[model samples]
Target: MTGSLISPRVDYASDPARSRGRFQIEPESRTRTPFQRDRDRIIHASAFRRLKMKTQVFVAHEGDHFRTRLTHSLEVAQIARSVARTLGLDEDLAEALALAHDLGHPPFGHAGEDQLDECMEAFGGFDHNAQTLRVVTRLEQRYPTFDGLNLTFETLEGLIKHNGPVLKNGKRMQDLPQAFLDFEHLEQLDLDTYAGPEAQVAALSDDIAYNNHDIDDGLSAGLFTIEDIKDVPLVGRIFHQVQKDYPLLDRQRVISEAVRRLIGVWIEDLTAETSRRAKRLNPKSVEDVRNLNEPLVAFSEKLDAEQKELRRFLMERMYRHYKVNRKRSQAKRILKELFGLFLSEPDTLPPPWNETAQQMTKDARARVVCDYIAGMTDNYAIDEHRRLFNLDAMI
Candidate 1:
């Protein structure tokens, strides 16, 4: 490949030089490809920095050892770059997508997202993917000419469509998120087809990273024991093997070894399956990869089934554990109260946001409030809730 450190670039890999270009044209970087520049921009974004304070399955205040969105994104980027390089795809684009994927996530993880969606339901429900697009295309305001980061079309397309085609058949299954609809007028993304191979790699990398980390977090939180997960599919087998090989190892070391081995197995399966798919499909270019009926990157069927079982275990023992649910409930309340307050009393918002909300319609005002709440870090949200709700607290 053109930028590959190990292997030659595949014919179907996305080429930064052939990128569709940014919405706002600018001088190209002399030191980096367009995709590399995109990665740099994402790394420098304010939203990306806030990810450090955004928790995944656990609240940030709960424990320092738990995985935050920032760590998760970094882990995903590492896995993505590894997969992209192994498959002769553009590692920079995969890394960029992985880094930017969670930039739109609100404080408190899924609980906050769910509350925000309910708060914004009448004004066009919130979708994290759409919120992510908005963050890059219109929310960030560091640039002199544009409000958001002027990312490449390839990065934007992957951000919007990484999970799959946005459209079902020839039409949207439902209305596009308002943010997505707003951006579509500026540039038409081919939403009916799959994203290019780098994006596909980044998407799967996210799955691999989160699954393994959640197991680690769940165990650390004491929501479940090693014995509890000893019967799960792929994960259980790995844990058993680790125990057999090092019978006297400590619990933490066993967990760490098992997670490490599981991640390696997932990466191997994904790369091999993707290579097999590419050989059978014989795509000539990135466009050919996108136009195919299915994704070019995937785990094997056996692995996929096993992965689902692992997810089910996490869902029951970890995600739905009483401790996690307690934090989630508190998170939802904070977001809900904040949204209600901001929407009803726009003048209470900070200076610029207050000024902006004054001129918008009610629906528009709701969106503005949504944007404000969505940008808060977990600790900030909690502190803001206390400041606003407790009369005894200093303003």
Candidate 2:
């Protein structure tokens, strides 16, 4: 265990003398650690389950193959794990982080989020990542005094980084080198911020998954054609990589093939570079990841470029297409009506939610309205829309 500090499972962040708020259900005596408990808590949470009903591109229930929030998260977890395990890092923590990554995304996908963001602009304003951090840290309550998953600083750090540097308390996080210093215990952490390497990989993995899957979903929904998608150069590169890395995977298997190939390339690049770097370090200790010379930087830059290009391709060809845009607009109407009905109108709201809304503050009521829409499954959101807002709602 002497040289084991270099291992990924090892908590690189200096230990916190105290991390308050324990897990609601501690894992039984086993190989699972606290982070695993954090992961499992997320896996089993009611919030996590709601992902099945949320949209990823084309809405759920429209077809079996269109991506759902759950599937997208699973893809991210799979990618993160492959990267973590290849380097002997902590796979469980990465898996957990991926699952919890999108817990704060509202119903109707980004459109619903856009409406909320605009409406709540006077408030903190909504960003999925910020909301995700809020969920695990405070809002996903199934308890009284303590809400959220109550995960460790390590896990929370992963969520924050995966979400990318945030704007919190009127500050953009990436600008501040002392991000971690804002936490409860400042001294224990070495880095001013502590987003594990796996967290960074997950952020990029999210981009990789959605870029391919969104194209597939759009085509399946008849919004675009594979030929239309192939016209984009980045799309061509993706499929090219897909065929080269995964000959057996068909064109339709874009997400899986792209993710698998990306992770493999990164791991191979990372392993070779780390090994080379190890040879150059002094006997006293290895060079920290920060000290890496140009090779690592070059690889990272290349990956970033590809990811951006791929995302842009998806945005142009599919995400912003007329067919998808029409549906997104309708879905926003559905959620907006629900927001006004359940939180603003008050009378037509469901009994339970109506009661909850009544007890909330004005701003809290609006957020509660957002949370209600966020928690709804795809089918259920439609059902609620009919029950509360539609003329045919009444029997």
Best by lDDT: 1
> How well does model 1 score by local distance difference test?
0.92
Residues 281-369, candidate 1: write the lDDT tens digits: 99999999999999989999999999999999999998899988999999999999999999989998898999999888999999999
Question: Candidate 1 has which clashing residue pairs, if any?
Answer: 1-8, 1-9
Q: Which ranges of candidate 1 are over 4 A from the true structure?
A: 1-5, 169-174
TM-score quality measure for candidate 1: 0.97
Candidate lDDT values, in order? 0.92, 0.62
Which regions of candidate 2 are displaced past 4 Å?
A: 1-31, 143-145, 167-194, 229-299
- What is candidate 2's lDDT per residue for 170-197, written digit by digit as tens? 5644443221322343233223332555
Worst 10 residues of 2 by lDDT: 289-298
Winner by TM-score: 1
What's the true lDDT of residue 308 in model 2? 72
TM-score of each: 0.97, 0.76
